[model samples]
Target: TLSQHPDKNLHKIAHTRSSTGPLAERVRPNQLCDVIGQESFLPESPLGRLLVEDNLPSLILWGPPGSGKTTIARIICRVTKRYVVKISATKAGVKEVRIIIEEAEKRCALCQPGTVLFLD
Candidate 1:
């Protein structure tokens, strides 16, 4: 079915999120300084430190809609030379997630860098 269950519908309120598609591409920061509008968060702060360390733990990016959660994920990957594979719960199912996960595992195996699995 091309529909979602009530409690799990991400698209029900995709306000500022780009509707182009889910995880269409990794949006790398244009420059180290191009990441704008995050006073509380810094480029090379604790999060930056983690990215540099290449041992970022899994996290649940919680916030109201349009809080730049998606933007931050890309910035994390950019700063770490890492790769983030975002997937929307509404547009994707377990099977698709599993497939991307397998690919991510391969990317991980090489110790390429950190990968942020952003979900909404």
Candidate 2:
């Protein structure tokens, strides 16, 4: 059934919003260029310059609740085009972390590219 749909129609359907999504989800930046504030840590900054050169690193972003830690992580994953495996520290346990690590390892072993494990 999915294969029967036209590609153009599928694109339109994918972009259509349900209107029930959270305000944050609705306004979230889809690209790094759209993200405002945090000028000192963006791609033009010293830290960002280093990250741009080496996108694969275990990074820890600590900030207040609304300070865009998640946003920055999403942008990093997007810019690098790396697979993202998100896990909330409040909800996930060691077993979940181990599974994610195993999956990431498997992806690496297959030469399928690396992943960004975003611990929210």
lDDT of each: 0.61, 0.73
- TM, every model: 0.53, 0.67
What would the per-residue lDDT of candidate 1 be over residues 29-91, giving only the tens digit for each residue? 344344556544554777556656766778666777666666676566555656777678899
Candidate 2 TM-score over all chains jointly: 0.67
* CA deviation > 4 Å runs, candidate 2: 1-18, 50-54
Model 1 residue-pair collision total? 0
Give the clash count for each candidate.
0, 0
- Model 2: lDDT equals 0.73
Alpha carbon lDDT at 39, candidate 2: 77
Model 1 RMSD, rounded to 1 decimal: 11.4
- Report lDDT (Cα) of residue 68, candidate 1: 69
What is the lDDT for 54 in model 1? Answer: 66
